[model samples]
Target chain A: MATLDINRVRKSYGSMEVLKEVNISIEDGEFLVLLGPSGCGKSTLLNIIAGLEDITGGDVLIGNRVVNDLPPKDRDIAMVFQSYALYPTMTVRQNIEFGMKIRGISAEERAKATKAAAEMLQMTGLLDRKPSQLSGGQRQRVAMGRAIVRHPELFLFDEPLSNLDAKLRVDMRTEIKRLHQRLGATIVYVTHDQIEAMTLATKVAVMKDGIVQHFGTPQEVYDRPANTYVARFVGSPAMNILRGRLVASDGPVTVAFETSDGEALVSGVPLSPESAARFRDREVLVGIRPEHFTMDTAGAVPLTVDMVEPTGPDTLVVFSAGGADVVARLDPLAISVGTKARFGVKAEKIVLFDPETETRLD
Target chain B: MATKSLARQRAMGQTFIYGVLALLALYYLTPLWVMITTSLKPLDEIYGGSFIGLPQTVTFEAWSKAWSGACIGTECTGLKPYFINSILMVVPAVLLSTGLGALNGYVLTKWRFRGANLVFGMMLFGCFLPYQAVILPMAQVLGKLGLSGTIPGLILVHTLYGICFTSLFFRNYFITIPDELTKAAQIDGAGFFRIFFSIMLPAALPIIVVSCIWQFTQVWNDFLFGVSFTSGSDSPITVALNNIVNVTTGRKQYNVDMASAMIAAIPTLLVYVTAGRYFVRGLTAGAVKG
Candidate 1:
């Protein structure tokens, strides 16, 4: 029954409305990642759920109880902050047991819980050391351990791994995923890193300017984004958004766009005939994931590669297409700079967005 | 030959620097030297013009007399009682002011609300307020409260004045502590005072030492408030020291005066010598890169 529902939450500071009527919910044990750029109100929404910040309007429900007026202490939750927020003076053991101590739990119980949490995080040797003595990754584990001991129904993480180096971030990311799987705890994690959102979240809420742009499972958001913003924001190298026109053919409707070389057409777009009729002969936006382009010699479109970026396993080919600098992830040695290449767009992978609204079509 | 000349040049530079430092040390130590030497000499030796030199006859008589026998304006009691009075006043005043200032800093930085800036601005303005400006109104209030010419009245005045600077010190230091710490504590089920005692106060040890040293020295050495507020037997050491130096009997007792002055100055000196390192450390601790 553990769940979080943010119902019609509206937040504003003075006359500046930071979050409009936004709503998102996650089932029990689902890892919900509120993903957005800085100042996009993702952190604000997380703070609201944690009861750290007062919501300007609407309700926050945790485990079927409205916690709008509950203090953070009474909200039955634990949070891991980006800075770790470990008590600088307390040892790791004391930091983990502090909440239990505050609630007047027995000393024996506190010791047992601290020991279990420390062992789970593999930091039992660091229990007696102060926060100042630990390195960044160790501090991050201590923070997670502190949250783990509480055994709260909900866990809130506010970009907990942003402080670590790239190598340590991946290691800790896997550690967090493992912890989530073992504990089966409902978690609401916030990060601007799309990779973290894609990898860690069971459900991802892509946000912009305080509004939820997309809310779905990781695969769902990647496969069928709700809008252009979500499509571009949720993927690396971002899904290429091309401005093109739709044509009504004897069979199915096709989107015709221009590559660097010449005109191209992609059919089999997932649109009904009735909806396709309205967009016929009208300019629309075509959303294509960078990986969906195939290198075929006798393909429909010809692309002139302007630059090639080889990142070990895969090569990123950048070409001017659909009035934008479009990037296509391809196999290494497949393309090089200053070369005109032919490619095929997987027609079934094409998504059409309304040019004016920037929303995905049917 | 080149290395030899370079070594010689470095030696010469070291000698020059040490020579200036030695001269400056002697210059500053001259008055203290005279005071100590004068306090050790007998009255007859001071009168016989062995003032700046070693005493012709060394004696503990003046030291004992200054400690237990000197009179301050008809009061036969020495600086002993007054020193006790200063301790009594300075201890409580320093504690109250420092504790209140830490609380002020905690609230201003962490538990912010509307007009918190204005309140902090007003407290900061209190720091620049001259002691003389508040003397009249303070005296009137003390008189109405029936606390005029009392040690508690002086403590009250010093604590109120000390809060301004101590608050400024603590607020600036506590501002460097991230707000996330306080929020984390709140989620951990700790209440306001619990968070303050467990998290804020433990982390504030350096700043607390800084405030204690500053307030102790200021309140202990304060003469204007000490003199204007208290009278006669209830006066602090500064006032008693002034009375002993100014009594001016048939022939001035320079030895007793100097001894009394040194006795009054030792506590502040001891305070500085003991905790001086933390003062510099606390001032720069907050400047660490975030």
Candidate 2:
């Protein structure tokens, strides 16, 4: 059975709509991430699933039961909030045992669960200390322990790592992934970090302006983006988009555009005949991932490099092409600033979108 | 060497500032010192000379009279019943008002509802109006309910007036706590009351101490409401102190009046001495952004 299902959930505050027709289903043990920028309602969607937020127009089902009217306590779900939210007055042990205590569990059972959870999170020695006395990362682990002791049907994380420092955030990211693997628990996580979505999510739902742009496996969303927005939003250093026109309409289609220095052609997957017929000699947006560009003797476009930024592993080169600014990631040693270069676009990696609609044209 | 002289100049400037602060502290404490000296002086010495000088001979007569023998109208009630009544009224008033106010603050900050801001704005405006303007109406309502002369009635009035300020204090303090804390509690299966009592309330200790001390002093030293709502021997110490000081027919016993006023202020003064650090910390902590 699917562990959790959110069907056509919509949320609005008065006339201001925050989430619209959002839908997702998590298989029994999958880690699904709702990935979006701030104010895109990813947290709102997670709250809806946790029953902390009331859905305005649809139902949420957990383990085959619709939970639209249920309160958070009855939802059988545990959540870890961005702030850690450890009970400030309680000791770490009490914080972990609070849920079981409220549920009227036996003292022995509560002790067992608290001990096990503390041991699992490596917080046993700190169990008697108040949250104020613990470090930020330690408090975060207690928060996780608090949720783990419940062993709820589903786990919800609402940007739980956003508050940590950079190094701690990376460490917690790996810790959470390990926890997921160990528990095999159903989790619905929300984050604005695309890197986190890429690294941790089994499936990623990219949201924009309160609508899900695309929902698929991370590789699918990255490799086969459904629209121009998804293509630009899912990757770091962003995909380079160039304005072009379809020059030929045949079994094998081609697009042509003019840079400041020269004109170039890139051939790729043919559009549908109808779409190709309509776009003949019409404007289209061609998107190419930065990593797909390569320096070759027989290159498709000639350009002057404006700048080259070399990090340890890769070089990011900024250059002008097709009357647009484009960035390409190349081998760190191969590129230099203020150099004239010719780079080829991998034709199979090129994506085309309708200029007006911005939807993929493949 | 020039830098060392500049540092020396800064140190001298700081010393000058501390000297001025010490003088200001003495100036503020002058009246209390004078009252204590006068309270211990014999009436003859008090009437004979220097108002700010040490007493020629210390005596406990004034304290004794202020505690047990002083007359309030026809009764020789001194300040005992009034002091007890003030304690009774202020204790429950502070406890209830601060407790309920914290709850109100927790709800408004965490579980915001439609028109919540409007409700808060109205309550804030209510705090600014002079308390006298509402006393007559409050008195009439209480009189109709047969609570005009009761301690509970005074408590209810004090708590009602205190809620606006106390809730404002706590709500503003709670807004500084990250909403993520409450959200985390909610996800841990904590209901509204649970999250409030377990998570928010515990984090709110400093503010609660502050609100309690503030409300206690306000209600304890209150004269207007105590005089208006309460009558007979059920009056608070402030009302008794006022009557003793302001009644014109009796010989003006300034010594006794000062002692009684000081006595009436002891509770709040003791609270300040004990938890003054928490008071400043709580107020500033609430004002901090996140």
Candidate 3:
């Protein structure tokens, strides 16, 4: 296992730049997830790390050695494509042993390695079956088996679970996590699914428009996104950014905004002393996660429930506030639409952004 | 009564379809039937009264004479040596063209470079070029290379021509295979030819059969190239059969001619009979979805 570092990486096609100067580094055995929507160049970054695509400018160092000019095989990386990419005609054993065969490994050693990989993947019975004969999950296991047999220093996964059904995707996600812990190999996994990133990654790089919007631990990215783009992209039902005026008085700081009723005030707003002094009475965007809004009877804000969605575990209540729609995840309470309810924001969880720049204020 | 009439109508539709298919099959098989029957007949029987009928005395004499004794343009050598020549020419030609075409298809689709489409477009344009257009220049090239009237020259000409179709077949076939497979192979340390042999060629069984059968039929049944490029004893079986049939001196040996035609046609017939099942289905199946 080896640490991977990408320094000032940029990719372009003539005049069209896909990846702007992006830098990210991960320690050995840390799972780094490049998360973004389609065309956001997350997969391009993964391919750049794999040496499958050339970078316009930068260095990708594996084990602290610059490997920018090495071929994919020479870089000691194994990739699991989104399609699994198992050799269709070969059986599971042959697919696992193919790399060793190409490298001229001895037959007995290849077979032993194949057997160990198949056993680890719990697919020993499928060793003789071709890829077409295997189910989607089995094919994914075989792909993993192929990569495991290579024993490369780094593993690359390009949305490997995207092709599976929802239930299979969940199972394979856990399976991949288990494999990562067991193998302890450095991995760069690319996915658009934020939950996969949240569950599987030690470090998450939320990308937008070829730029790294946020690069930190998943909780850090989730609880404290760097900007509005990441604030909305990393969460389900998304964080609601409501326009409001910040008021810093002698007692405490509070944000007041227009509610369905006259005006609503969220007091005890958390901010640094410098931010409190600088933005004492300035316009700001208040960011509140869905789960951070609680049903408080004595809260100052009154919101009319516009829509309700019950996702079995929690209820999502949509309301209009500060001239934008807001979603609040509440307990499965028997709340009806069009009802005026008072909700309070958790002070510690609230993030304030500068209204002009849409960046975090503190 | 309604159900009975419906059943009867369905039976009638089936009968009509079978009737038309049977008539078409018989229409196509008539020449083959006549060839088999006339080849079994003695020359005297064919000349006298039983031109299209079963021979009064079926004999192997005509078949044996057609095999080893018939004269063609005063060489008096039978179609045997020419049949061997055609075999020598067709096998290598089919193999080489198919191999080259497979390589071309792999490169055009997988290991692509700049101007790949232009190169493939030029090859596709070569597919529609008339055979007569290239014969003069090809003959000149053959003469310049000291391969004029040789079996190897014919092999070279057929191989060069066959690459267009074979590459077309293989490129279309290989394109259906996902690019991820080769990329995965590359990461697995397999080089260019390693991926071709291990991944591509194995998946290419159906297309290989298709290319071989097509090239074999085209090269085997070609009369113009065989006749124009070679003469006398060095000719392929088609030219030798033409020599056997177009005699200017004596009565036409219709039985020997029929037997020689059947002999020359048997290889392609066997090729089709054995490999035709894969022709339609093989091109569209394998290597992508599941």
Candidate 4:
């Protein structure tokens, strides 16, 4: 296992910069996921780590060695691609043994590695089949086998599960998690799918416009996102950002805002003494996750429900709050269309951000 | 009664499709039938019988004569030498052209330099040029190089023409392969040559078969360059066949002429028969990838 340090790495083609001065450092044996939308430079960063692509202006260190100029092979890394990228002409055994053969390992060692990988993936029966003859999931497993047989210091996965069906993607996601645990290898995975990052990453870096927005544990990212982009990008149905003002009183901080019927107030919302002193009478954005809202008779404010989407275990209540579309995850049995419901959130669950900068405050 | 009528209508549709196909097949085979029967018949009977009529008394005289002692301008040597010459020219020409083309295609598609597409466009323009237009300039160049009227000269002409076609074939074929495969191979310690030989070459069998078949047919059937560039024993089989047929001798030996034509066509027929499956795959490989 090895640690990966990306120090102010920048990439550009001509005058267009694809990666800004970005920095990320992961310890040994951590599954670091770079998650973002398309054109956000996540895959580019991953390629720079693997040494498949050259960086414009920064240093990348693998296990304390600056691999700024090393070729991908000399960098001692293996990548599983989004397309599986298996050699179509080779049988699974040959595919797994291809790298080892290039390294001139013994035939006996290659056979042993192939057999162990096949058994580990539960594809021992498929050792003789070509990649085209296998299913998508099986082909992905062979790609993994090819990577694992090298026993490289780092395993890079660039959206390896993107081509799979939804059910197989979930299964392979769990298998990859298990593989990470069993091997304890350092991994840097790039994906546009936020759920994959949330489920697989020990440390998640949310990137946007070539910069790292936030880098922290998954729970910390979800609960206390560093900015509004992370809050909206990392969740299903997304977090609601409501434009309102926090009124400071000596008793307790209260959020005063417009309701569907008329102006209403929600008092007793807690705040850090630092934030309370700073934003006493200014407008701020409050971000509330869908799951944080609950059904209450006398709650923060009353809003008219526009739609209720039933998703089996729970239902999504869609309503308007402070001129933004706010969604609440209410009990399935309690939600109905065209209903007047009062929703509430705990003071600690409410995250405050500056309306101008959109960064979380206190 | 309605169900029976529907079944009858389906049966009628099937019969209609099969009938048209059979008619087309028969129409295609008429020339082949005439050629085969005419080649097997003796000269006396060939004159005695109708051109469309099958031979009543078959003889192997024409075949043996075409193989051994048929005269092309009083040489009287059969097509065996010319056939050998064609093979020798085509084998090296096809191998060299295809090797260069595969390397060119690999570089153009995978390891591209600056303005690669512009370079490819210029190379592809060679495939569209009329060989008739280049025959004069080619003759001048060949004369200057001191290779005029030689088999090696013909081989050089054929290899230069074949490169554009074969390069186009391999380029379109290699374009269908994902770049990720090359990247993954790079990570696996495979250098440029290693990755090409181990990964790219093995996956390229279908396209290679296609390129070889195309090159064989193109080089083997080229009469314009063969007749324009070489004469006498230096000529390819197509030129030899042309000479044997149009000799304007005492009496036109139609049987010897037909037999030599059949022999000239046999190699291409055999090539298609052997690698026909891959030929179809190569033609349509890039248009629809699976």
Candidate 1 regions with alpha-carbon error over 4 angstroms: A250-252, B1-10
Which residue runs of candidate 4 sit more than 4 Å off their true CA positions?
A: A249-252, A267-278, A331-333, B1-24
Residue lDDT tens for model 4, A5-123:
99999999889999999999999999999999999999999999988888899999999999999999999999999999999999999989999999999999999999998888899
Name the top TM-score candidate: 1
lDDT digits (tens) for residues A260-346 of candidate 2: 568778776557788888888899988889999887758887788888888779988888877678988888766566777688878
Q: Which scores greater on DockQ, model 1 or model 3? A: 1
After the best TM-score superposition of candidate 4, give how far the Cα of residue A13 lies from its true spot, in angstroms: 2.1
Estimate the TM-score of every prediction: 0.98, 0.93, 0.96, 0.94
For model 1, state the Cα shift of residue A59 in Å.
Answer: 0.4
Counting clashing residue pairs in each candidate, in order, gives 0, 0, 0, 0
Clashing pairs in 1: none
Give per-residue CA lDDT, model 1, range A1-362, as digits (tens). Answer: 27999999999989998899889989999999999999999999999999999989999999989999999999999999999999999998889999999999999999999999988999989999999999999999999998988899899999999999999999999999999999999999999999999999999999999889989999989988999999988888899999899988644678899987998888777787766888889999998898888888887778899999999888888999867898888888756588988888787888889999998887
Q: For candidate 3, lDDT tens digit of each residue in B242-268? A: 888897367888888899999999999
Q: Summarize candidate 3's per-residue lDDT along A1-362 as a digit string, tens digits.
A: 99999999999988999999999999999999999999999999998888878889989999999999898889999999999998978988889999989889999999999989988999999999999899999999999999999999999999999999999999999999999999999999999999999999999999989999999999999998899988999889899988888886644579888877668888887788888888888888889999998889887778899999999899999989877898999898889999987987787788989888788877
Better of 1 and 2 by TM-score: 1
The TM-score ranking, best first, is: 1, 3, 4, 2
- On lDDT, who's better, 1 or 4? 1
DockQ in order: 0.90, 0.65, 0.77, 0.82
Share of real interface contacts recovered by each model?
0.86, 0.76, 0.81, 0.98
What are the clashing pairs of model 2? none
